[model samples]
Target: MTQPSPHPTLTPQFCFSTVALRDFLRISRASIDDSITQNLNALYTPAGQGFDPSSTSVRAPRPQNSRQIAPSSCRAFKDQVLFPSWQVRSDVLNYCASVATSPDPDDPESVLRQVESERDRERVVNERLDPYSARFFPREARTEMLAAVVRQERSVEKIIRARSWGLVGERCGGDFREWEEAMNEWRKAREK
Candidate 1:
């Protein structure tokens, strides 16, 4: 028996179509970007672990004695800096809130002016941040905005909790409504 000619050989086919070329270019660009990001992350992080320079336990960098030898030894050293995007966003938001709430001595004019200036700074920051950060955390997206969203969500949650508490009040020993009533009675007695 020929034994199916030793299991039919498979040959690869190359497509040089315009679609294929476009796809290839796209894939190549993506891979290049990903590799650059990884290298950047590597510089900030240790092998197989995330690293943050701001953290207390800063790792001692390798001493570079020679160009060839040092590079081979300390392969983890990447040139890119992995700035904390979330922290920046949180800080910007905090600044905006502080400026809005707390009156400054310098600008006795409308607090709106201060806010507008802060918004301008925010825009500058948004422009300066890398593509990934600009995409994820736009300068226009304030911390207060996120807080407002959270507050709204919490209100909805509180409503659900109120219903849930009503259901479980008796089972959990007493209703919150009864407790509130008792507290009101105590307050009235204290007032008298």
Candidate 2:
């Protein structure tokens, strides 16, 4: 009859849920998540294997760096930072997101420029409201914050960077909801 479907394990949605799809596409989970449509195209019509998902293809290209591993469009939310003007840079804190294990070429000589003018700081800058560092934070929000901070630029205000750094370090800690509240306040004030 139907030859019992050669591959019993594969399912329409399983591929999407599993890492195999990424390995097949030669991209990272972040890359796939960043642009599912693009990755799907690549998966269905792979540059390798002559457009045959069944056929084996050349090994996926290895990324030289973490960022390259994922498409640039991928937003690292946890890595993102919110500034006084409210600009999103997505690349400013790439390495600073974590404690540097090794010397980084991208490290800023000084974050002195990140501070705001006296009036601006006083008007817009809010003190770290949460006096106690959080013992635990949900994983999802942390991940989102990383992406959000990564988009920020070097010229960003220090207070914003401080908050982000604190969050990442889990020191000046809170959850995404708290962050949203603060950001919304800053955003609304700026708009008016």
Candidate 3:
């Protein structure tokens, strides 16, 4: 009978996609729409006479130069400025949704399992989009992988340094040629 093919060993791999990341954020935002609306309303009172509890008048503030003016400006500014801001936020939410739905290029398992928690996903996207923040993701995985390789190399070097055969003639109390021969034999045995 023919022998069955040997099973391949699994190795860790990094995978990510802009589309998947965006979709994840979108789904998370949709799940929390009510909460978001409430929070936005709390933070920015809608333009109306009773919008602001502190104001004696009934009108809401106007948006000027992208800043919300006091509760005394025209109501049109609120609709034009504040409402559009919310719309932009909603667009961002949609972008996130697209990302979450996209297929991962590196690791299919991670994409299927949604290994990145919703909060972490959000944080990563937010940080990435921030103008002042450094890009720490989408490339961090590769950076970390390279660092691990370097660390492993260093460890191997240390082991070689500690071996008696690795010592030079002055340290081994033998001829340089003898030490070299011993080291070569040691490497051959290790390979086997």
TM-score of each: 0.21, 0.16, 0.22
* 1-192 per-residue lDDT for model 2 (tens digits): 001101124332322232442232222212322343343233232243345554446666653331221222122232231232123221213333332233333334223323423334455323476534333222333233333433332334344445443433242223334545555665677689
Which candidate achieves the best TM-score against the true structure?
3
- Report the C-alpha lDDT of model 1 over 1-192, residue by residue, as the tens digit: 000011111111111122432343334323332243333333332333355557657666653421121232222121111112112222333433444344334433446655766765676334455655434323322333434543443354345434433432322222346423533454466468
What lDDT does each candidate get? Answer: 0.33, 0.33, 0.36
- Candidate 3 lDDT over 102-139, as tens digits, reads 54366434443354445346653455568655443342
What's the ranking of the predictions by lDDT, best on top?
3, 1, 2
Name the runs in model 2 displaced over 4 angstroms.
Answer: 1-81, 90-169, 173-176
Which ranges of candidate 3 are over 4 A from the true structure? 1-109, 112-130, 133-136, 139-147, 150-152, 155-168, 177-181, 186-192
Report the poorest 10 consecutive residues by lDDT, candidate 2. Answer: 1-10
